[model samples]
Target chain A: MKPEAPMTAEQSLALITRMIDQAKGNVTRNAFYFLLWGWIVLIANLGMFVLIKLSYPYPFAIWLITIPAWAYTMYASFKRQKETSALTHLDSISGWLWITFGVCIITLIAFGYRINFQINPVILLFCSIPTFMSGVILRFTPLKFGGVMFWIFAIVSFIVGHEYQFLSGAAAIAFGYLVPGYLLKRKESQ
Target chain B: MFDELDPLLHSQLRLAVMSLLISAEAAEFTFLKEKTNATAGNLSVQLDKLQEAGYITVEKSFKGKKPLTTCRITTKGIQAFEKYVNTLKQYINK
Candidate 1:
């Protein structure tokens, strides 16, 4: 029979302490990302409601259905565990897709109708700034780098071309959120 | 000369959690619990220790009226992690 090695006091305490640190990190990151994404969804959806109301007749009825869609997406996102690596990326992408679609619809409606409201791409561009900063704060290179790309695209769209604004939003999804999120998920799996 | 890492931050389970969190923006209690395969009571206890050490901060709030607890690493914690890694590298290189 092999002799069991005695665990040192230093070893045990160090082990316990390390676990605690990690648990704390996990809790913090999840909460921040969830809130960040949730707010983005809410803002996008609310924008959608406003545009739909202004552009179409009988807006309240549409708002009712749109609210449910938003709720459903929220439920799905919250209920989802970090299961399959691919699923996690898919979920983020899909959520961003909803926000992108909502934003694009509103933009189209507002621009098409020539509503007096100036479509300030700058405001939308600035909104993404924090997300990019969050990526930097976390020190994840993929997210940080991708965030820069999103920021660049945002700036370009606002300064150069309003026609590509919606496309910029889609690009944000592909690079900033989805791709890096997927890569992280893959690293986790490995 | 690099000394050994403080034993307090060098345990396997703790190291695993920290490693995961180092890469994450934030993660949930459940997520950490599942990943580390630690019991709820054990994980909670460990988390409190880290919070007490000033290596992390804990936030207690309610989500939809359900009690929600979250954690985040502090600057102090990141520094300690880096130092610990450097300490370990000394042994490997030596």
Candidate 2:
């Protein structure tokens, strides 16, 4: 095939479309990180809810699981970066968006005591932005809907007491991360 | 009447390479070859031509035991590609 042949406008347009599709097709939708954080946050949220309902003295301590989760996520991200030979615009944008989300979460946790632990709703709200943006970038409707679900849960968490917020957070993680992550993994396999 | 398309971007292989690079921050030589289905020698020649025109920057390094070549489009390349597309549109519209 003469890939260097001169082209008319139609041929040029066709070639452009073909190349863009090829580049997009090469993208590996590895949802491992999403699944990892999904289960971790889901468990943490539900665990906290159960502890609080049981009248445990330090129910909030359950969130300490995030420390180990954060470490694992960093290690995984590094490995993924080393494995990747190309970085697409979507990948760069989504990576930075998640990094920004991570920084925001850390900041919120650092000041959680000052905020009287009324941080769940804000966290859910924050999560929606990156999730929605990621969905848009990847052109995945499930993830976009997942982001909307997070917004709805955030509103619910805001209206409920602190104890109920954990339950809402758990629901948010289930829909926002787990469901879409699974669907993405299935799509990649197919 | 249509403006002339940029010669550097008017060829099939070069245009294909530019299109791929346009959507990516950077791409490896193998990735470009795989996408374009171009032979390594031909791809190397076209890449060198694009580099000489200051349209792309190619970096060579060793990744573990293998040598890796990565290419990124320059600002000039992006502008030229955009102009080429616009000009192509004019030709198609006429």
Worst 10 residues of 2 chain A by lDDT: A22-31
Off by over 4 Å in 2: none
Task: Give the true-contact fraction for every prediction, in order.
Answer: 0.06, 0.74
Which of the numbered candidates is closest to the native, going by highest TM-score?
A: 2
Q: What is the lDDT of residue A189 in candidate 1?
A: 61
lDDT of 1 by residue, B1-94 (tens): 7696765565555555565555454556766667677778777777777778887777776656667666667788888888877776566566
Candidate 2, which CAPRI tier?
medium
Best by DockQ: 2
| Candidate 2, A1-190: lDDT as tens digits | 3755768899999999999887776655757877998999999999999998899999889889889989988898888876787788878888888999999999999999998878999999999999888888888998998899999999999999888899999999999999999999888788
True-vs-predicted CA distance for residue A114, candidate 2, Å: 1.6
Candidate achieving the largest lDDT: 2
How accurate locally is residue A159 in candidate 1, as Cα lDDT from 0 to 100?
64
lDDT of 2 by residue, B11-41 (tens): 9899999999998889999989888888999
Report the error of model 1 at residue A107, Å: 3.0
- Per-residue lDDT of A1-190 in model 1, one digit per residue for the tens? 0112333445544554565554334321332342344445434544445655477564324325446655665665566543321122223443464466557655654474475433435434544554455454444577666667667766766665443454555555456666666665565566
Task: Tell how far residue A158 is off in model 1, in angstroms.
Answer: 20
